[model samples]
Target: MNIDNRIKFRHLLCFLEIARQGSLARAAEALAISQPAVSKTLKELEEILATRLFERSKQGVTPTSAGLAFLRYAGPSVQALRAGVHSLRSGEHEAGVARLGVLSTVESSLLPDVVRRLHDQHAALVVSVVTGPSAYLLGQLRVGALDLVVGRMTDSPQIEGLTFEHLYSESMILVVRPGHALLQVDLRDRSRLGDYPVVLPLAGTTIRRYADSLFVQCGIALPQQRLETLSVALSRRYVQSSDAVWIAPQDAVRQDLARGELVELDIGLREPGGSVGICSNPTTPPSLATQWCCEALRTAAADYRAALYP
Candidate 1:
């Protein structure tokens, strides 16, 4: 089938947006069209290509195998077209752009320094960063919505089609406010954790798995009075104002630790931490800006590891 004659750019746009959003209504909103219109476009594209694109359900849509395959080409093609238009409108040479996905683990420490150095070195380059759970970020990376992701390598089905490079290992720390009652308790007593309210990452996140494993290894049950979130701001606030213990990545609360705002509890689980790293779609060649950002991230990781180990 001659796709040039049968398919329009709008078809690719609609298809890509649906794949990204995983819902017809959400894709329609994003594309500024009615849901039926987006659905119609998807049907037309599927017919043209002689393949079913998405598997729809009450919750939303997920890309079929063919849809996932098509997304690799469609997403980059659309992004390139947008970059071209932006370049033309700005009357400047096409500056490189990298869309990055980040996990919360690196949000406070590794990401900031890397972004600062990237901008300092490439003033005209555009870097867009999106932070989310590793699973979601890796999904976007697979579909070409993200150039790369900085996060822990998870043993998840979504990680199947991507490549990951180990940068460092990140351990979870149990922390409390500066003068919490737990400070006087024995560090080895895991059961004492139940005496206080707890803040933890939402279930299913990579770090949360490690956090949960720590409790299991110690033969301690998760606290009944628990707050589950990935928001560092909320966890920090709650831990400081109340006797809530926060389970978080050491990197995430580094500043607070240094400032004596939070104190680490020494439960002393010897389990090795998760591998922190970079994940990218192996099929998508990195653009100039993406390559530069990758290098910056490696440098930042190197410095961080040296500081920790040295």
Candidate 2:
């Protein structure tokens, strides 16, 4: 279809917003425009595609079959274009900028310190931090959507053309509200852990997988409870008031532990240690900003390791 070039990026963006939000009114509100403006833009899109993209029903707009198929390709294209433009705009004269993808786990653990150090060292460089699941983030790095990712190497992730450098090691622990029975050294036994209701991250997440492996390795079944979430705040709240033991990275709950808000299990459970690291595509040369960030992350990991373990 030789669609006119006048039907441009904005039109596709508007259509995506409507598709994502499931209503023209919501999409218009998100775009900070009038509802009629959204309606007019969708009309332009329908004309370009030569078909109805949305089924207008009482339930609001739902993408038609053709629209669904088109978006599967278009969405990624737009994201890639945006990433490319951001890269170009952020490039430097001698040492270009790099986008760093960080899984939330690592971001919560190490990024704050690393970013500060990076800024202090490379005053003129730009580093954009992106977040997502490890699998998704690695795919983005492979396709130049990102230059590097700070992620946990808790499991051997299966991805091609990527290199992992071990930045530091961390151990998992059972965290709960201060003065919880589990923290009582006398009650902090293996059998006690098996008896308590535990709040755990979803099984598929790296931390949960590691905890499961630890339980299996010890030949013990974890006490049944809720497979909750990865939110530190929510878990912290649960631990503060309930008899829920949450398995989490030591770094994630360190401050709470120090403040007497939460306590780590002294159960002497077999430690399940994992490496936190930096990942990048081996095929591409990393920009200076990326290299700097990697070094800064390593430094931060070292400092954290010393504070937590030493």
Candidate 3:
């Protein structure tokens, strides 16, 4: 394939911004260039491709099929170029940076271990971590804004178009502070859990489905009084100080359980649990730092996962 020598980074940059903003004017403002310059650049790109890339309208510009096709390649190229430029700018000795998105489940245990291992090996490397729901983070991953997404997001609908590698399986655990009254009795008693305030994952999350299922499996009704949240820190803190029982991802409360700060209610789960792993865009060639982090995640998870399931 003979690539056009006239095609430049500027052309792709302009096209991406125009497609993203849906207007030449907005793209111009973003790029700090005049609208005419934006139009001219788009024209040059279209000419180079010998195809009409976008259709102009009173509302805005919409990408033609060719434009969308160009966009898929251009987006990753720009992101990789930007990341490479960033690594070079950081310093010759620096290990570089990897952007990672973490869903809530692994944020507490597995993620920290991965980071610690990575930094210990390459102190100069910066690992930027973004925390959010699976859908949002996976969307960023598919767009190449994120290098890798960690945690249990295997069940997310947004996981389409990405690859997930399972490191281990995790399940929800019902926990409460030590010496709680409920701790003395049979946890299977549906009425016993309802007496104290309950802490749960926010409704609609993958973890919440497991939490809800636990109750149904045990024939327990949803507690009338419950604190709905996504914050592991908040839920852990709240559960420790009060009689509130927290339904948490096992990893989230692992340390607490080990240190005797929290105790799990022995309600055995029939199912293995949610899959915790790494999600990445197989199309994107990983940077050195990302490669290091991925290696670290796999190495660390081997030991971590062994202890978890065994």
Best by TM-score: 1
Write down the TM-score of every candidate. 0.92, 0.66, 0.78
**lDDT at position 219, candidate 3:** 76
lDDT of 1 by residue, 1-310 (tens): 4446788889988988898788999999999999999989999999989999999899999988888788767877776676667667764556777899988888877898999999899988888999887777887786668899887756656787678889988788889998888888786867888877889888887778888887788788988999998888888999999999888888888889999989988777634668888888777767788899889999999998998899
Alpha-carbon deviation at 94 in model 1, angstroms: 5.7
Candidate 2 lands at a TM-score of 0.66
Error of 2 at 248 (Å): 1.0
Q: Evaluate residue 3 in candidate 2 and report its C-alpha lDDT on the 0 to 100 scale.
A: 48
Ranking by lDDT: 1, 3, 2
Off by over 4 Å in 3: 1-72, 87-93, 268-271
TM-score of 1: 0.92
What residue runs in model 2 are displaced by over 4 Å at the alpha carbon? Answer: 1-97, 217-219, 308-310
Q: Which ten residues in a row have the lowest lDDT in candidate 3?
A: 86-95
Predicted model with the maximum lDDT = 1
CA-RMSD of model 1: 2.1
lDDT of each: 0.84, 0.73, 0.83
Q: Tens digits of per-residue lDDT for model 2 on 196-249?
A: 677776656676787777666556698866656767667778778888888877
Query: On a 0 to 100 scale, what is the lDDT of residue 259 in model 2?
Result: 83
